[model samples]
Every structure is written in structure tokens, then in C-alpha cells.
Target chain A: MDRRDFLKCSLAGCSLFLVGKGLSTPLSSSALAAPPSQLSRVEARYYQKLPDREIKCELCPRFCQLGDKERGFCGVRENQDGKYYTLVYGKVASLNVDPIEKKPFFHFLPGSEAFSLATAGCNLSCKFCQNWEISQMRPEQVRNIHLPPEAVVETAEKYNCPVIAYTYSEPVIFYEFMYDTCLLARRRGIKNVVVSAGYINPEPLADLMKVVEAIKIDLKAFTQDFYTNYVRGELQPVLKTIKQIAKSKTWLEIVYLVIPTLNDNPEDIRKMSRWLKAEIGPDYPIHFSRFHPMYLIKNLPPTPVSTLEKLREIALEEGLHYVYVGNVPGHPGEHTYCPNCGKVIIERYGYTIKKKELSGNKCRYCGQVIPGVWS
Target chain B: MKTSKVVVITARNVFSGQGLPDPRVVLKMFRKGLELLTGASKAEEALAIWFKPEDRVGIKINTIGRRLLSTLPETSITLGLWLGQTICREDNIIIWDRSNEELKDTGYKLSNTPGSLKIFGTDTRGAGYTEEPIVNRNIGSLFSRIQAELIDASISLAILKDHGLAGVTAGLKNYFGAIHNPNKYHDSHCNPYIAELFETDLIRRKHRLTILDALKVQYHRGPSYHPQWAENCKKLIFSTDPVAADAVGWKLIDELRARKGLPSLKEENREPVYLFTAEKLGLGQARLENIEIVEEEV
Candidate 1:
């Protein structure tokens, strides 16, 4: 069903909620009546146990070596008696039925609805995190519902959403849950997609690529200084992740949030475009998202539309195939223009797909094949 | 220049045969530590120097280690009761940590009686974190309302242990429990984040004292409880300078490590450099030569 039908069904008490401005869901009556004090205690995937009851987490580049009872930088994984456990597995903190375009996969399954959810916690702490209420919190700090992998897939099927998205907060922190749900969703003929900051290890990302169909990475910046001072992460690892995803069969899309005076350097954007063209080719789509003052970055103003347009122009000039501007409704850059005929193949306004001039992954006017999944 | 004074009060039999602290001996140590730290003949005069009678004083305890290696209830309750009896109202004295579960696991009964001593955590019904983030230098977090709004003065009654990242988890590091995102600050070996978090006005302005519970020092492979590397030091460190108290706590951990033929924290390349950062921020003295340590057996 489309988002309009989904909204009408939600209004008719369909037990599904739409994600709105707050980015949070009210606790169900059952969850509120008996709040769970304990979080999920599943064993984490990538970690090495050391001597003296200590364990080093290998999930992210941080490699947080923790003592017994100490949590990693993600705040969702902990070391208990020399064993690393992910405390957020199956703990659904936020649930929403959103449009596929909200995940901003402009090239994948346009105008369809996606069943999206996220657990509490993230590996990277961005200074301007938009979803800090859930992303920057531990599992215990947020209200959660116990939705196992089976339940997630079943809900997606019930809601008629062909794709399930691990989004909102960083999905890599909830790797186990997302991986398991992807596996389950695959068995039921459903597609899986992930939205993340891409601050993940290669091994986990490789395994994730095998199960998911598409991945959208938030490339915070091109410089290590921006990663250190603002993102609390490393740029090399994120670049590595992007390269790895591009090499794999998974469809890749990139989003660069343009902050005022932070990462809006045109030269850096030129460099990033050149690098992406050289390493990953130009078939992938890149979105220059507008950033607003949020979390700890209230000092700066919202990114100007002119800045995004300039950055988009630079990326297009660098021989990139598809580039777009995001978070700005009704901008001409929101539409997908064909590289061959230069006609707008797909028109969009925010999360809504206004029109599609495509016939079976090809431009209807010129028969130029577009690089995306069109069924 | 006058050096910061740090008082170490020791008791040989502070712990009972069952591995719990003795309340009576812990109370004696508090009395002695307060008297020596303040240069007052009595502990009541020492309490008055830091707190007013109407002040709501918060004793921020470290309970992440649970019962194995937390700031024991016997030690913190004695200090809280003493502070209540000497200066603040009984109900105004709060003994708290990050969560009610950890506090309960560490043998702290949840209490909020109107005319009695209050013991709880930041997770209490009316005591969550502040809605907005407080930005201070590189640190930005929502502080616990108990530390930010409820209490007029704070005493970091923390467990003295060797942290895997921070080199030493002591008085100043205890304030990590007061923020909502301690995990975010664990990067860069917790260097400037720990010091910067303490430099925030919610901590620096209201902080009145530092009390390190060094009765059982986890000298190696800690902030966790590893009995093989644990040592019974039977000491409580006190200082008005938050950095000096943690610096002394670090020394005591090094002393314990030396006794066990282990490398110093500096050799391990994780030397709690936040102490030096704290020193630079004018929070307190981190160098050993800049501190006057007064030791006495109670």
C-alpha cells in the first residue's frame, strides 16, 4: 500500500504508527503497564576476549577494549564476564511505517512504503545529530518493545510493505537485530535496506551486504578533522565502508548533510566527488542534504539552498551520473534527470514521488536505462 | 604557592570477614578524614566549611560495579548520615548513582522518606536528566536532575579503581554517572571529556568535596571487579580539590600495582591524563609535588 492508504489505515486503528516530527512513538498500553527493566542479552558478533575478563569490541573502528561490566562506545554492547553482548538486540525503541523515499533511496522502489524501526544507541556521536533523543541514548534510557525478528517480518508482511528498513538511528549498532530481521525478511520474499553513518567494520558490513538489497550511507564529511571534532569517528573507516558497499552487489546511495561552515567546503566536495567517481564509478546517486541546527550545534543556521545547489553542481561537473538536493521541498534538484536525454525521469517533492516517466528502468522518451531497481 | 591538601584516613579492619565494610569503622574513617582535610577539631566544623544547613547535598556514588566493587553502602551511608547530622537536613542529603537497579544491586535500599535520609538514582520517578543538553567545551550532555537541579552541593563519593581506558576511575570520573552519555565520552582514553565534563558549572560550581572509597582498590583490569588483581587498601581519600583527590587515588592504585609486580598505568599508556587536563583548567592540582597529603590511621 502507498503512504496515503497507510495513513488512512493508521487513522482507522491499524496498529501501525507513522513517524512524525517528534521521531518517537508512544508506548503501547501493554508496554506501559509492565515496563521492562532488562534489555536484550544476545551475544555480539565481532569481538575478541582477552585475559583477565576483558573483551575488545571489533564491531566498529573504535575497537573499545572494555573490562567486565563495562559498555563499549555504542552504549548498547557490554562486556559481561569476558563475553561481549549486544544489549539492544530485539529491543525496538522506535517503530514507524514510512515512505521508501523517506529513507531517501531515490533509485530504489520509488513511491512504495517501507516498514522502518530502530533500537536505541549509536556508535558515532555526531554533534548535530537530528535523532539524538534515541540515537544518543542507552537501551534503558528509552522506552522499548520486544519485537523479535519473526515479529518484524510478520509486521512488514501484514502492512503490505515490500521493504523493511533499519533506519532513523545508526543501524550498525543494532547489527544483530537488523541482520536477523533481514534474514527472516528474505525468507518471506521481502527486501531489506539499511540507513547508517557507515562507521562499521568491514567484516560485519560484508555479511550485512549479503542479506540486504540496498544501503544508504551518511557520509558526514571527507576530512578526518570533521570526523574527530564533530562525529567522534574516523573518516577512513567510513570511506572504506562506502568503497566496500560499492564493490558489492548491494545498491549504494550516499547522503552528505551540508552544514554551514562545517562541511560545506566546495573544494572538499569536489575532492569527494572525484574520489567517488574514481573509486565507485558514477552510477550511484548522491544526495546533498540540508542540515538544520540540532542537538549541540544550535549556533549555526540552517544550510542554504544555494549552498546545496552549488555542491550538487560541483558533483555533477565531476562526471557523476545522478546527484540531488534533499530536505528542501519543491526544488528542481529533487527530481531525477536522465543522464542521456536530460529529461526529468522521476519528479519528487520531499518524501512524495510526484511523477515517474520511466518504463521498465528506462527513460520513456529516449529508452536510456536508469541505474536502479525497477519492478 | 600553597599546595592542595589531600587527607587519607585508613582503618586496618574496615572490612568484616564476610567481605562487607564495617559501618562503625567506616564512620570513624569519615570523621578522621573530614577533620584532617578541613583542619577542624570536630567533623561538624568541617561539614560547615563546605555546606550550609539548608543545602541539599548530593553524594554521587559509583555503583556500576554492583556489589562486587562498588562504593559500598556501609561507606557512603556513613558519610551521608554524618553530613545530614552535622549540616544538611536528613531528607536533603541524597545518596545517588546512575540507576536504581545498580543502586539496589549494590545493597542500597531505595529511600525517599520526607524526614529521613534519601537514597536513590537518577532513574527515580521525579529525578530524570535535564531536557536540554549542556554544552561545555568538548562535552555536551543532559545532566541528571539530581545533580543539576535538586542538589545545591555535590560530594563525589566514588569507588577508587583502575579503569581500562581512563587509567584510573576516581572522584572526578564519578561525575560520568551524572550525565546521560558517559559512553560518548569514553573515546580518546577519556582524556579531555572527563576533565571538560567536570569543568561544567553544574559540577564545578556546586562541587564541594571529593571522597574516594579506597577500602578495596581494583588495581588491574578494572573498573571491573577482578578479585585476583584487587587489593584491600582500607583507606578513604578526601580533598576539596577534585583533581588532587583522584591524583592520590591514582597513586594508591599504582602502589597496589607495584606490590603485585604489575606495570604502572603510565607504562600501560593510559595514565588518566584527564587529571592533568583538569589541572590545566584550574580544577585542582594533579602533580604529586603540588599536593600535601595527610595520612592517619583511625
Candidate 2:
């Protein structure tokens, strides 16, 4: 290797060396991650092979009709020699143990830690993607650990985490791995949770619901224009996913990241609040997340704290019970209020729950049922 | 405004039954196309105008489809060796794509010998993508170091094929392989992103030529191999304008589709509208009326 080439490799941080075809020689980490050319050949689910070697991915609304050597928009799945495969399968890019509330599942397991994991690639190309390091990259672009589904469950068990959260990046892109991990986690008396953009199709989402205990959907905006322009996706599919999750036994939560003037228009928030109250009911906790300038949307300023508060007020005024504000750590709006008793049911300081005024899903102050999984 | 010129050079029965493209015939097509496009007296003169003797040339070929359908190795190496022999040093020219396995699968013998035409991929041990994604308008991608740093000049040697989403794949789309994440840009019929990606300084500044290998065009059900739809047209398309080259490729695909009694890309609603988008961005000409199509039988 030349001097410049070695410098480039070293700049990529820690990387494993490829020994041959399938084997990677464990050397000291220095250099770029090996090209994910060593992709899994396992055929993907929810896809149909066409007349030629083309395959149509029914995983999301994109319905990517991929040719051989072509990948879906998600950047993880590939149509290799006619059969479709998820390249990021069992390839974990990021892993950590964090509070379940960090996924911001305010209603489900408030104080418990979630064993978080993510693979690279997301179906939607959100301009303001906070986790773009992993989400926007191809599997080879990022440093990855080959943690199989069984290993993931074992690691979570070893860490004493009750929930295995598929988060940081879009879990939908790594469906097979997440599904298998969820199944394995369930067998071991552990729950699985998904944090996604909800840019998924009905069949896959339905299938995913059977495995996951709860799902947190990031509803970026209320309008279709925002979806088309900024998200590179359709808003209707996310709406459908939210409605589907609400219908299923899976606990559902929504997060609308208010990005200053982009998606924080009061009328749009009001419209979204009303739609949420009518479609998924007023009980599903909707968090108005504060958007910090990130990814491609760095030119925009962070969402004003007042904007998030106002949106929270509009949702509450629209008769939505579980509206909350996110990101601004010490904001009083982070706490879940009892709609009936006008009392703070679950007082939280960021991801840390300070106190829980609840008795088995019912608010301790008013005996009102809070719609989430509580033990 | 200066009109774009695209050349279509055909060498009838250029491919042998053993699946090798005739080097002499392919070289003749390349020389003729360049001579016509640049209005130069000789092929070497045509190349010298765009490249310096010391320039490192990267002949980027689309080889995702393996052996059955990809830019024939003989044709690409012939052009690379021609460039090395004429304008640049043989050691400086690289015939590359995305990965070594893909290059091998496409029937390329991996070579990195100095004083010889180097054939490798971005995934070659000493080569990979740039550290950061070069963001350009709608495109944010990590470019291959071969395109971003190693090469001083580029020639897109792409295989002509009908894409399911982009409607047509040619010279401009060939650069997709030069980036780390091409899968993300395939949305919206590859509109805006394809144009925007080509606009990136890494590609736009370095790219000098577009050569589409239409030896066996996959007219339908393609970008992949479907023998029933593969046509042995035995042609090579050339242009300085990337969009105009792909636009000509789109027309050729539609013509083949019509002959096979299949719907046009427009009728199929997967028309590579990216050409129009590219034109609007002032990259090149999208209209056939504006592009002077020079046909030759070499």
C-alpha cells in the first residue's frame, strides 16, 4: 500500500482485515471496514421474482423492482443473481444498552433499560436524519459487528436488559435480523421494540407486529409535501403503519420532530393531532421532538422550544391525552399528564423517570387507564 | 448554446461464440467515435485535447451483471490500453468498477502490474471509497478513491441496458458504481440525484468521455440478463455530454422495445426523466433534435 492509501485506511478508524473470501483475519483495528462484498446470500422475504432475474421488494411502499446486482433504496438489501438478500442481515452496526424512554416509549417500560441495536440503511432518506452516520450509509461504509440473532439475545440476557430495542437506524431495513432476534428474545422472556420512520408496507409491518412488543414511529410531518421533498417517502404509508400498530396488540407511540418552520406549522400540527385522536385514539402518546440541525438539513436552526410547547398545547387542545415534548431535557412537558385528573401520571426528567404515579396501567391519582404496557 | 454531439459506431458480428469481443473491431469503433466527436484528424489527437500525457485515466465500467451482461472485458481493456498507448502512460490507466469479485465475475483478470493497464475495483486492498460523503445538491455519497483521488481523468465505459426504475442505464449511471451507496439514489426514477451526482466535483470535474457498450443490449427486463430480451446489436455509443449519451441510449432501448412488441419506457412510465432533469441543470442536452447523432459502420 502507498503512503496516501495507508493514511486513508487509517482515517476510517477500526476495521477488520479480509483473510480470504469468507474469513476475516483479526488484526489490530486500523483502517477502513472491509467492503460488505461478503454479503449474505439468504433469500429475502416479502419479495417476488419476476420473469427475468428482477425481483420486486414488497417490504416497503417503494416496491423496488431490483435487477441482479442492484439494491433496494434502503441500501442494505440486494437482488443478487436473481434472488433477493438483505446484506445487513446479522450485521450489527451499532449496539448499546439505554433507557427504554430514550426510544421515547413513554408509555411502555418507563424506567427499564433497552438493549439497543441497529444495522445500516433506512428506506427513507430523511434530510434531518439525526443518525445519518449509520442510517444513510451502506453496510460497507460503516464499521459492523457480526452479531447473530442468538448472540444478540444472549448479549441482552448477559447485560440483564429486559427489552431488545432495534433503534439508532431504521430497523425496517434489517427486517430478517430484527424479526429473528425478536423471536429469539421472545422465547427467552424478553420483549423487542422497534423505533422506525414507519415507512413500511402493510404485510411486513403486520408480520413485524407479531414479533415486536412495541413500536415507536417517527411521523416526520403531517403533510405529503414534506414527505416528498425532505423525507424522500410518502406520508400516507407512515400513517397507515401508525394506524395498523394502533389496531394490533403492539404498544404504539408517535414522535413528530418539529423542524422550525418546515413541519412545525400550527395548523398542520392541529390537523395531525385531530387525525391522531380520531384514527389512533387520544391515548397513544405523541411526542413533539425538538429537531436539531443535522444531516443535510444543517442550514436550518434548531426547533424553538416554544414551537414544541405550542405544538404540544395544540395536540392537548385537540383532545389528545398523551401529548409530550422531547429533546429539551428539563422541559416540564416531558412528563405524562393524567387527562382525567389533570395530574402528572409519570414524571420524567429526560430518559430518567423521577416518579411513576401509576398502578398497573391506571393513573394513581384518577384510576384512569393509560394506554400502554405496564406491570 | 453549443449543441451536444453523440456518435453511434457499430461493428457487425464483433462478438465471437466464445464470448469475447474482437479487440481490433472495438478499437476501430473507439477511434472512429472519438475522431468524429472531436473533429480531430487522428484518434490520438482527439484524446490529447482532453488528457495530458501524465494524467491518470480511470475507465469506469458498469459490471454488476457479471459475465452474461456487463461491459465486455476485451472492449474496455482495448480502450484503456489505447488511452495508455496514445495519451497517458499504461501504468496510469485503471479499468475499474466497484469490487474485485464483481470485476472477476464480469470476466476481468485482476491486474495491478506497473507499466501495464491496471484492472481492479474500488474494493482493492490499497483502494476504497473516500472518507466522507461529498454532498452535492440532492446527492450525498462517498465516492470511490479511484474517482475522488487516484484518477485525474475519467471515461465512463458503461453497458447499455434497460433499467426497471431509471428506464435506461448508460454512461452517466455508470458513475453510480464509483460511489459507495448507489442504492439510495435510485428513488424517483433516479431523477435529480443522477443529475446532481454527476454534478459533484469529484465526477463532474474529472469526467472527460462517455462510452456505452451496446454489443449486446438488454432491451427489456434488464440491467439484468434475460436471454429472450438481450439483443446483439454490436454497437458502441460515444459522447462528451453524459446526458446526451444516455438520451441516445434511451432512444435505442425504446426502438428495440418497439421491435420486440413491448411498450416504450414512456408508456411503461419508467422513462429516464433524469435526462431532462440533467438538461435543466445545464449538464447537457436531453433532446434528440439538439444532439447531432452521427452513425458509422466501422
Candidate 3:
């Protein structure tokens, strides 16, 4: 977002924030550096204490075993004197009331406002990270507002937001803070949702699925080579997360950002669509998001609308129930259609839900049951 | 083949008991190092061989371990002051690390004197990291302005220690402190990324020296302080070839580990092959056979 847009978005009551000064220029990162006073020393979860003041983090597949003063790949958790601590426990880098559609949860709550928040630092270093200003930084390198779990719950309640979103940066990195906030938000009659890279370990993912109502996993690519060479992560763990979430009662959605000449191959999309159909079944919504020139991958052009359309067609042909093309507003792919009886069940323009013709869980036109939480 | 030279200097009585290295003896070691490395009669004349009067020299020290195990203030300041008084202007040399807090924790009083030997960190207001990242191979990191824009030449004045992750943390690994994202590079025994980071023009072009402070070496369970595994090695290794300097330092760590009946870093499967990667990049020689070791005790 630009400076003007940031100022405009700050109209949400009782909220304060500071974005990087220059919109065109990259964040000096100096602007993001939080003072020492803003730091949190909260002991972390999902880590094993090893001998001699060392630790091995099991939060993710990396399983980073660190000596004292060492940090995991995520850059938010650290091993301080043999105990693992989450430096960004309550440090919120970005907080705003965003449309649930922005998270592209077309199936889950089409038009509801979400209290979206994120902390600095992400586990995966995607070469084309869209939110690198905050995601690709240590807690000390970002300006953070100290909003404890109670404060987060209260903020969502005050804003009249039905759902709270752990998003922007990878939510799994701030699992402790997010999990605590989720528990509090749930008690207060609010729903909790997560937007993540799905890079979490099975134990943590299993635990997280029990607390959150829904999850949006950004499946970077179908290939391990893409995960390794570009995303600096493993593909199997992400696939496992999808499978686990599919087995759970919690709502699940998948987004595949198609970067030009990167992960946009037709063959990979066919394989991914077939796999999703076989494992998660045809009910789960899959989005083919358009990739822009961002972070370190600025040289490539934005994903062509033709590419998104073609991929959407491929997925649809592969028998996936609901496939949407993202990042291009007003495209037919942005709207929801009933797979049982083809009709526009929910028309959307950008983040705005233009029209909804659904009665409970079924399409109003054909009495066909379209999956998702509509209440 | 022109083999690299590594000078290992020691003073037996430099630390008879628990105290910092004796400044007088340390100065003699530095003098001998420079004279022998450059074939000069004095240290000041030796500095002229590699650095010009106009160059701003940055002595990048590893200060992550706090007071117990870090590049001590005694070694860095003494060397910075000597370089200022001899080769460059007093203000031209900056002894720096990642942050002011780490520097302070390592017993360094933050200084930003415009016309004196300065000792501070990247967090010292104007010395923060650059806005954009310098991309080279697998390394995409924002370099501290101290190493990128402020200094014309660089020195990795690193602590010699056995790293749990990198197998050894020395000259090449110390450059990790110069970047904003060292944590990202620590994967895979810090291979290729360490070498690639050192190959970045911001580092490779400016780096002029490598000095490993081995007064007290942590032979095992380190990159952290565990007195049981640490040894008072009473040594300082000097070399212009960074890979060779760290390779020699790695050999010392393994030797100490062997003496203490501990398995090698390789047996533990965390060997630092980045030196070999660095050697492949023509940064320096990694093989001991290709490096000449010169020992001295002052």
C-alpha cells in the first residue's frame, strides 16, 4: 500500500501504525527496527531442550537445533540460555480491519470484516515474497506494537469484527501469540482464521487445527525443486499440512500463486489439481493467485491474466469443484459457482461481494449443496 | 601455485590466570604478524602495502556471545587504535558488529568520535543496514552501511570457536554479522551462502584482513559459552586469505576437541565446507596443504 492509502486505511477507530516512509523505495529497515523496550521474552512452545544450553526447534520441518543466542530460520524464535523464546510473542507488525475476501476465503464468510494482524518474521524465504518489508525481518528490525493476546481479542471485539485473522507474514512463526489470541477470541464468541504457508510440523499443525476455525494455505508450487531453489522450504510438509487440514473439521482453502516461468507450468497445475481432488476432495476451494513483481523477483512481469484463466480452466477440467482466479478484480473467476449445477452463487468484485444467491449451504438457483460457512 | 601464509602468534604468560590478554604482548604479536606477512620492518610500513591513507578500514568483530566469549574490547580497540595511529586517520577505522547492545554486552563502550578510533555498531543511528539487499547467488541480505557504504576496506576480527551449526565460526562466518539476515544463511552448515555472502561486492571487494582471536577457544558446544568445553588457547591467527585463516582455526578447534576426547565436527556431521566453497570461488585456499603455517610465541 502507498503512503496515502496507508493514511486512508488508518480510519479504523482506536488504531495507530507507522508504515515505511517512501512507497517506491524499499523500507530502509531502519524504519522497521523496534526499540529494545518493545521486545518480549516469552518462552516458546514446540521446542526440545538439548544438553548444554542448546535447543532443537520442532515447530517446523527445519528442526533448527541451536546453541545459546541462536535463532531458527524463522528469525523470530531464539535459544536464550538453553530455553527457546519467541521474540515476537506479542509484537504485531501489521494490524487492520480487512475484508475476509482479501484473504480470498470465497467459501468462508464472503463479506465479513476480519481483524487481520501479523508479526514480523516468516519461516520460508520466498524469493518473490509479497510482504518482505515485514515478513523478511527479525523482530528487532521492525517497529512492533505490543498487543498481548487479551488486547488482540479486545480489539476485535471493539471493532465488531466477527473473525480474527493471523495473516500477512507466516502465522506459524508467531504460533504462541496467535494460539493464545485464538483461545481468547474463541471464548469471546469470535472466530479465528489463519493465512499461512503451511510450513508447520505435523504436531504443531494438529494442535493449531483444533483451535482455529479455518486455514488458507499458500501452496507455492507442486514441485520440491520450487520449494527448495525458490522458497527455501520442503514441499512434502506443506502437502501433509493440506492433507491433515482436509481430515479436520476446520475449513480449508488453498492458494497457488502463479509466477511467470516459475511455478506456472500447465503440467504442475494438472498434477496439483488432481492431487487436491484425490486427497482434499472436490469441495475445498482452490485459488490460482496472480503473482506480481515483488521482493527479490522484480525482474519478471506479473502473472498474465491469461495464465490465471488457463490454470483455472485446467483445474476446472480436472474436476475440482471450486477454482478461482485471484488478484484480478471483475474477472469471472473471482466469483463463486456451484459445481453441482453451474450458476454464479456469489458474485464478487475485488474484495466486495456484489451479490449472494445462496440459501444456507445450497445454491438458491438449483438447490445444489455448495460447501462453505455461510452464516 | 602460490600457497597462502597463516601466522599463529602466542604468548604463554599472556593469561597465566583469568584476565584479558596483556596489551604489551598482544602489540608485539601484531607487529611481528604485519612485519612477517608484508616483509616490512615495522607494522605501520606493513599497513601501507594493502591499505591507503584515504581508506576507511572497518574491523568487523563477532560479538554475539556477550562478555564471556566474544571478540574482546582489549583486542579490537587496541588494534583499531594502532591502525589509526599508524596507517589511517584516527576516525577512519570503525570497529563494529551487528548491534550496540551486543557490542556493549561484549564490554565495548560505544563510540562515534568523528576524529578518533570509533567503536560502535550498525545500530548507531546513521550506521544501520542499507535499504536494499545485495543479491549474490543464494545470498540476499541487507548489509550494514558500515560494511557497504561507510568503509573502503574491511577486516574480519573474529573469535575462533567451534560452532554447533557451522562447524567453526571464524573469518568467513563473521561476515554473517555484517548482513541483516545471518539466520537465513545458517542452514546446511552455512555452505555456499557463507561463501556467496563473502563473494558479494560489498564484502569481497572491501575485505582486506582476517584476524581470529583465539585467546580462549571454545573447542566444543560453542558459538556459546560453556566453560567445561572452552580452552585458553592463548593464540591469535592472522592471514589475508579469509578461508585459510578460518581453515587453520577449524584445524585448531578439531585438535583441541581431539585432545579433550571429543569427536570431530565432521563425525558429528556439521563440518564447515563453506571454506572449500570459498576456495572454489577463488576467495582463498581451504586445504591445509595449500597454506603455510608460521608459528610464534612472544
Off by over 4 Å in 1: A1-37
- Report the lDDT tens digits of candidate 2 across residue range B216-241: 99999877788899999988999999
Which of the CAPRI classes, incorrect, acceptable, medium or high, describes model 2? acceptable
* Arranged by DockQ, best first: 3, 1, 2
Put down candidate 3 lDDT per residue, B219-260, tens digits, no spaces.
Answer: 998888999999989899999999999999999999999999
lDDT of 1 at B30: 87
Q: What are the per-model DockQ values? A: 0.50, 0.44, 0.61
What TM-score does each prediction get for chain A alone?
Answer: 0.92, 0.91, 0.93
TM-score of 3: 0.96
In terms of TM-score, which candidate is stronger, 2 or 3? 3
Q: Over the stretch A34-119, how does candidate 3's per-residue lDDT look in tens digits?
A: 75535799999999999998899999999999999989999999899999999998788887787899997988888998888888
**Top-DockQ candidate index:** 3
How displaced is residue B143 in candidate 2, in Å?
Answer: 2.3
Q: How accurate is candidate 3 locally (lDDT)?
A: 0.88
Per-residue lDDT of candidate 1, residues A126-224 (tens digit): 999988888888887777766778778877888799999999899999999999999999999999999999989999999999999999999999999
- Fnat, model by model in order, equals 0.51, 0.49, 0.47
Q: Candidate 2's residue-wise lDDT over A1-375, tens digit each?
A: 765554344323213322122212222111236465655556689999986677899999999988887888898888877899988877777777778988889998889888888877889888888887778777776677766787788777876989999988899989999999999999999999999999888999999999999999999999999998898899898999999999999999999899987998999999998898899888899999989987677888988998888889999999999888999998999998888888998888988899999998888988998888885
